[model samples]
Target: MLPSGAFVLVVIATVILHCNGAPTNCTITLQQYTTIQIGWTQQQVTQFLGSPGIIVLEVGTAGSPYQMISVQYSALQSSSATASFLFMGGSLYTKSQAGIDAGVYTITSQQYTMIQAGWTRDQVTNLCGSPGSAISESGTGNTASVSVMYTVSGTPYASVSFTFTGGQITSMFEVGLSPPVNDKITLLQYQTVQIGWSQQQVTQFLGGPGIIVLEVGTAGSPYQMISVQYSGQQSSAATASFLFMGGSLYTKSQAGMDTGVYTITSQQYKTIQPGWTRDQVTSLCGSPGSAISESGTGNTASVSVMYTVSGTPYAFASFTFTGGQITSMFEVGLK
Candidate 1:
């Protein structure tokens, strides 16, 4: 896929007009379309479509969408446009639009891996971490500037696009979408802990043990560090400063550098899923402060935490999560 826009092309299961699953009638499944949205990279698409066959990109195409990126795929032996995915920007488009026939959408005519669709926002976030970035349509019905884009680098991969409207995804297309320039696929998972949540709840969500507390500096200037893992093991350390005298909280992680006084209103701070893109964090937490830390691989990353109240940076406190949900948090500051 190109950097112009990001989209997911998934084949869906819908009633194909009058086809009765007959031998002559080509059977199309919606699986391909849905799978693409869950962050299925171009390599995965290649496994299903086999060599794009035809690749196209229109620079400044009129009438349709600006900075349009698209890819056309053939079913090896078939010479017709079986199916395709379209990406307007970071948000995926749908095939449910007019003129698109569910029966002949070539993208699903062949065989490949399977990924289920109809997942909730949280479910998709949990599975694919967060989109590199996301862009929504303008209120005036015009296209918005491309934010998060997808690339395919140099491989038999397709830039998949997924479109959502009225809360639910409406259509999907494989062609007319940009193939990413870098085909590297990055996976992120969020582990959460909430305030008042017990160790059992933490383990149930994060898979247990890996969670540890470490002390920093001397007894008089001591601080605590919280560490947890996602898919594999996390070798990074997250510091949480409990200022008993000032009644303030401090935390740091591998994502970003953030500092603010928090209140330990509650003794327990739950750890939620982590590894969220800036957009995802903003959508949930607004423009809150950031936490900086290093991953197990020593990779530096930022963690964004938003405060429930707005005022001084350290005047308010909020719970932090890796992805979307709240992880571990504490209340600080004297009433």
Candidate 2:
């Protein structure tokens, strides 16, 4: 004796109840939602979530040619919550959920501390899990760099960026919620450079320098040195020089009050005799432009330091240490 609409509602309710049966609590839990991995395919995701409410496709940025696809699904709860998964190159990249106050991805301080200058891309991904977004920059030929960003839910104003050069992590830092400017490279960007990095790698991280001086090697010699200078952000006059030998970073010298010309007085050079401790030499000539330490058999070890110098032509001071003491010192200049 019920009205037609009421009868239909009753039938729908009965069908839902029959479908659910038993305990009848069908809401999706947080644990159920987080099982999705980064490398899953669209078909796999659809199989897991049944069907998505909407699917959007857009072109990828920079290096990738594949279209980026976004699949959105509604949560099974009464709150009408939704989750969106992003896919690139037919594989999952990241996911986000709305109306979820808790974090979808978690990165601890210990994990952050584990990241180092020389870590590989796979190593970083294994330690931090998958990032929220990945950006790629391709330079001349096969050289390229990728930056992966990890953004936490509920806190949209903070993110962590891991930049890779030649498949190795060259820099990692926290950035504001906003995107970075395309042109200017900040000082924080410069801090990412490490020893033995290539010139192309430096450019990929810090952009181009203010001045570039290329020293072509002699005929038939494969070794070449390049000196790049950058004006400081705080002080326009302040400059830092990066020297690369045979296409690799050899040394870095910060701007100082002294003129670019590095000179050693005869008396000062005489004081650099053997048997001098590194501390004593450092006290006399300040710190070297760059230093490298090597371990020998037993307790013996040696250290090499490069100092910038200027004379008839450009030159560099080289000091070798053995047993923590100076063994020899010499100066070499351009021909």
Candidate 3:
């Protein structure tokens, strides 16, 4: 099939909603933030800081009681100076400096690569070399879910998180780790792929029967979900993150991917904007940006687009959208 005409976009686990023309000198300080009162509307806080804060994390849909959003601002170039604002129901409730302080450096990028979404808590602890700290828990017994965090040391701005239900990871996220120089996908069964291979054929070549992570439509139909993950044997972090839909491979990716994913430009970032439909942005750029990641829950869905420049100064940008319209964005080095 030819590339789709348009796509919805948003950030990953850590949503990056970048604002064009946002004031740069408005980062918050731990001491300065202590003086800011709670119960302030986001706009009031923005006015106090002289800049709008960048939304770094969002959970739940708007107006939902469980909805939560975390925004990060530029700070002093010191590890201890890191800070973020928490808004519950659109009002500032608290502020935090989450990583680094809590031995966030306990997990490394290589360690993170070995863990899978459905892996048990013990499996993760064994691989990561430490029992991850449980930050929150809900439900009970088999229905229980726990959220854990592992901050990577040395790098002041990176951490890994896992949310487990029934003792298996349901979702995971990482921050600040650059995709490896060569994402471990060279030996992926993906290279030997044919467009429409059955699940059995895929399992036969890929060694393991990839699990079915999602399903919809009918039981005995063509839209079944089957996903198989293959990793490199040498520990170069070679991993093939791909999936099969309706008995055919439809999505394929590898770890540490950094190229062939960007499609937006600096000029477009300035022109294309929130509330614009995917069709509108595609029309402006003449191409829909390549999608690097996607995730959704309940009423919210997000996709990522990495736009880059060709020469001297390479850059990357990610914009968020829902209901097929742009809502927010994040960018680095676009010129």
- Candidate closest to the true structure, highest TM-score: 3
Regarding lDDT, does 1 or 2 come out ahead?
2
Off by over 4 Å in 1: 1-31, 58-68, 74-81, 87-164, 168-335
TM-score per prediction, in order, is: 0.19, 0.29, 0.36
Which residue pairs show backbone clashes in model 2? none
- Tell me the tens digit of each residue's lDDT in model 2 across 184-220: 3334444456657777788677765334423333312
Give the higher-TM-score candidate: 1 or 3.
3
Candidate 3 segments exceeding 4 Å error: 1-105, 180-248, 252-335
Clashes of each: 97, 0, 12
Residue lDDT tens for model 3, 1-335: 34554233233212223543533454665445545555676778777776666776899899876678877765544544455777777787665553323433288766775566577898988888786765544455686766787877788787777878888877676765544443323343454654456666766776554323333333334664545555554544445555666666666654543334446667877887678876787788777765554444234555555566656255767666665677788778875
Using lDDT as the measure, the top candidate is: 3
Name model 2 segments beyond 4 Å from true: 1-33, 58-68, 74-83, 86-101, 104-115, 120-158, 163-171, 176-335
Candidate numbers, best lDDT first, in rank order:
3, 2, 1
TM-score of 3: 0.36
- Least well predicted 10-residue stretch by lDDT in candidate 1: 106-115
lDDT against true structure, model 3: 0.60
